[model samples]
Target: MLENLGNRFQDIFKKVRGHGKLSEENIKEALKEVKMSLLEADVNYKVVKDFIKKIQEKAIGTEVLKGINPGQQFIKIVNDELVELLGGTNSRLTKGVKNPTVIMLAGLQGAGKTTFAAKLAARLRKEGETPYLVAADVYRPAAMKQLEVLAKQINIPAYIDEGNKDPIDISKKAFGQARANNYSYMIIDTAGRLHIDEHLMDELGDIKKAVRPQEILLVVDAMIGQDAVNLAKNFNDKLSIDGIVLTKFDGDTRGGAALSIKSVVGKPIKFVGVGEKIADLELFHPERLASRILGMGDVVSLVEKAQEVVDEKDIKSLEEKIKTQQFDLNDFLKQLQTIKKMGPLGSILKMIPGMNSDLGDLAPAEKEMKKTEAIIQSMTLQERKKPDILKASRKIRIAKGSGTDVSDINKLLKQFSQMKNMMKMLSSGKMPNLGGGMPMGIGRGKNKFF
Candidate 1:
């Protein structure tokens, strides 16, 4: 998502790698580039200034690592600062001491509050909590219906008072309902306006006063850049937001909101909305996000996502298949679907160490993967299990069935053969050191067949 910023910083690091030692002048020059990159990424100017200042101070008189180059040292300093700019550590949801923890969602209109509420409900459900979704946004027409639809999708119970326009009254009644029903958590989706207005503030403030919520989370659109920071500050000044939720981070955002909101609003980003899907919400982790922004990759998050989707039994079966070279087209297609469930290919690849850089531009990779998936899906079960049976005529027929050309089919088959060969080598303990030939690894290596 921060591809532009990542690429710009990568170029800066390449320049610093040529220098033998960090001189004051050279360091300043490098920081200048870094500053430009942040500014271009729409990061807050003051945030950028303070961040660069921290890196410069740390870079000066810093003892270089034994085997690390000056560039790597500079990268380390910047990475640490980036982590600080985003929250330094994970901020978790606060639980209410008593039954039914009340979490009030507040934000401007179109900030995805309702959707995030549903996502939170689903997340809590996954964690074995009985969450009751309260549709308290009585002012907005269809707001209650939206919450109901999402609740139904997630199989969570929703409490709504459609006729009641008073949010505070609805919330009070919903609290009573939660108590009677023994719900562990109560999520109140408050109304939002097109812009911050006195009336909206008054309504939210009254609801907060009446409910005394354990968490007042401000849902913000990450693509709004610095406006998100100002909006968060205003909300925190009034209702005192306990945490922030940055939404739509899966888009091509410059990441300004994520970097600036916490420092400006004095609240941690408790969660982030990565996609529109109900399952796309992720807990905010500063270190992992820092690694992502610097192109260092987040292996921990990668493994966690894999564990979530890949069952232990499935992994055992897949391991057996890999060991026996029985990973045929049917198994391959299944693996592709499993990977698709984890998220976008580019995002998944970014979690692998050094794979982000090795992929270069991922648009082509994503496109090619989609094409391969389409072709595989179009094949018959027999064809999938025994791809060797597909002769030239069959290849043409499959291409037509997949709405692709014969050459496209040939390209996929070739790539599949190469991938199978690589898998065999990897399983047979015959894989070569990729660095011996490929400067960046994989795509240009001696075994760059894939």
Candidate 2:
């Protein structure tokens, strides 16, 4: 979603680079471009106006830092303002001091309330908290069953009183069950309803009063653009929500909701549903998102993602293989499998500095990874461990089995050999440019498309 915005910023900065000392005209023209870019991104017009005003105020009289051009100085100013406009800091979900903390989720229909509840539970479960899902969404067909299935997949307990149609009754029983079972927290998945539905609002109000939840979160669909801002306002006005959970955050939405919700609703977005997987929810960090929007990669989020899915045993084994100079096709395939778990390769690379826009334009990263994996899988065990023994005849057989030409195999071998050599140098304490060595089409400085 930020791809276009990043490209726009890059273009504007290139134009700014043509100037030695930025004049008032130069600043005005650049700010005009920035304003247009923000408007095109679906940001609130008032927010854009104020954002541009601040940037112009700071950019007009700012002295360029030593060794930095006016373009870079302007980028810094924009980055700072973007950070502030994006909430200036991370808003973490607060854990209740009392055990069995009740957290109720409320939102409009089709806003992913049930799904976000399960995602939140799965995330909390990963953090060693005993989270239980409460299926109080009695209105939606199969909503309870849906929550049950998701909980079963993650091995988390779920409370579903399918016989009871009253959401209030279900919520009361779920809380008791959670407390009786010694659970740390209970996430109540309430029924979704539009803000205009007074009957549904009364039902939600009854549930809130009965449960007295410590946290009332609103699950919002981020794809609705400007309507998301209005939805948040209405929900906040009625429920006085503690924070927000944005679903479909990884979609191709214009990102106006994320940029506008906080300012319009005065509520921080606590978490974002980044993917469809149960483990794909992420804590929302305003500063990191601002950085990504400005074409700077979010290294912090990348590291956090790595920590979540990385296996210590696999890391140790891979290190041993690298240190012994025995890393081969099998290890390479294993590495690809790990990357797959880390989410899409394109999404991952976008988090690395200077690699913001390489994936989509340069190559199909996910397909390349899959193709590489298939090629590796087709090779015999001996061939994977010892590629030197593969002669021309064997290459032909392997190529046929892997559904590729001999050239693909040869290219893979060449890249593998280069990677092995680079690993050897790194083991001996030499830092080299990774841009030329990345497996997929990920690059930074003057590298060809993979």
Candidate 2 regions with alpha-carbon error over 4 angstroms: 18-23, 361-363, 426-450
lDDT over C-alpha atoms for residue 155 of model 2: 86
> For each candidate, what TM-score against the reference?
0.91, 0.93
> Best candidate, TM-score-wise?
2
How many backbone clashes does every candidate have? 0, 0
Q: Candidate 1: where is the Cα deviation over 4 Å? A: 355-364, 392-397, 432-450
Model 1 per-residue lDDT tens digits across residues 254-371? 8788888877777999999999899999999999988887888899999999888988998899889888887788887777788889998768877876655545655665666677
- Predictions in order: lDDT: 0.85, 0.83
lDDT per residue (tens digit) for residues 1-450 in model 2: 678888888888878875667668888878899999888889999989888888888888677777989898888889999888878888877778777988899888899988888888888877889999999888789989999998898889999889999889888888888889989989999888655588877888899999888889988888888888888888788878899888999888888888888877889989999889888888889889988887789999898878767888988988998998988889888878877788876688779877776445435545566667878888999999998887899989988888888888888888787789888888879875675446444345433333
